[model samples]
Target: MIEVKNVSMSFRISQDRIQSIKEYLVALIKGKLKYKDFWALRDVSFSVHPGEVLGIIGHNGAGKSTVLKVISGILKPTSGSVSVHGNIVPMLELGSGFDFDLTGRENIFLNGAILGYSRKFLNEKYDDIVAFSELGEFIEMPIRNYSSGMLMRLAFSIATVVNPEILIVDEILAVGDESFQRKSRQRMMELMSGGTTVLFVSHSLEQIREMCDRVLWLDHGQVKMIGEAQEVCDAYQI
Candidate 1:
């Protein structure tokens, strides 16, 4: 289960200073700062049960990604609390955990470790990851040499193979070709059938209708509606 209670987040911007002495004095005495307060999320609360597929829909800059970040524990809420049970695999930004200077094979180990997999676990699944990525010869090459699509493929493959209890996907399906997309969608279906909870964030309404059991519509960091996928999508269209 996952519960988000009255969560909100904000950021502070600091002014630039020229002199070191002046900077130190300002830091000590004045400490003048301005807050933009983007309010990526504000008093938003929701809950997801095990094996539930919850789709988040919103316009650009509607705090969709922010909610995912908060749920994934990558960003702390300025106010309120978010509690999640069981392990989570967040496929938010592709290649987020990779080292550009390292080879793709090396980055696989790094990413798998970040996902809490043991070396033995990764070793057993290494071939599956490489095969899914379809970057056979390129796997040994540095990730920096690979294209953006290749990087996304490698990252997505690693993240999904872990079979986390809670999966959070954010626009990662937009990567790769038609065949890869089909395979990915099939993999997601398999996970859902296995009773894994999924939180999906995507702009594709059709895909949401096909994959998600429920949908939440958000606007300006607030929930506009939450219910059946068809109903929320209809409301979102208007």
Candidate 2:
């Protein structure tokens, strides 16, 4: 289960900058400084029960990603609190945990380690990961040389293999070709069948309707609606 209470996040940006070190010193002496504040999320609250697939939809800069970031513990909420129960596997940005300089084989181990998998566990699952990625011989080469699709494939394979109690997917299936998209969808369904709670964020209403049990609409950093997938989508369209 996941519970979010009155969550809010804000970012501060410097509005005025010093031209040089001397100017910075003078500004400090004069006590003249400027900044601007932007709130990405405000009083956002929601919950996900076990074995639920919750889809989130919103326009650009509507705090969809910000909400996911807070859930994943990447960014701390400036106000309120988010509490998650169980192991969480966040597939937010593809290849975000990988080391570009390392080989695909090496990165597999590195990523697994970051997810708390031991070297022995990774070694046992190595073949499954390699087969899912379909990089074949390229798996031995450095990940920097792999195409974006290849990197995404590898990342997805590793993330889904462990069957985490909670899965957070953010716009990952939007990449790759039609066939890969189908495979990704199938993998997600398999995870759902295992009773994993899934928090899915995507722009494709069709995909959300087909895959999610419920949908939540977020607009301007607030929950606009939540209900059955089609019902919320219909309300959102209105």
lDDT of all predictions: 0.87, 0.87
Residue 147 local lDDT, model 2: 90
Clash count in backbone of candidate 1 = 0
Minimum summed lDDT over a 10-residue window in model 2 is located at 11-20
TM-score quality measure for candidate 1: 0.88
Model 1 vs truth, CA RMSD: 2.7
Per-residue lDDT over 1-238 for candidate 2, one digit per residue giving the tens place of the 0 to 100 score? 9999999999876567557999777777887766678888889888888999999998888899999989989999999999999988888876767999999999999998887677887889999999987889999999999898898899888877788899898877745678888887788788877888999999988889888999988988888888899999988777
Task: Please list the residue runs of candidate 2 whose C-alpha ends up more than 4 Å from where it truly belongs after superposition.
Answer: 16-32
- Residue by residue across 66-115, what tens digits does model 1's lDDT show? 99999999999999999999999888776777999999999999999988
In Å, residue 124's CA in model 2 sits off its true spot by 1.9
Worst 10 residues of 1 by lDDT: 10-19
Candidate 2 vs. true structure, TM-score:
0.90
Clashes of each: 0, 0
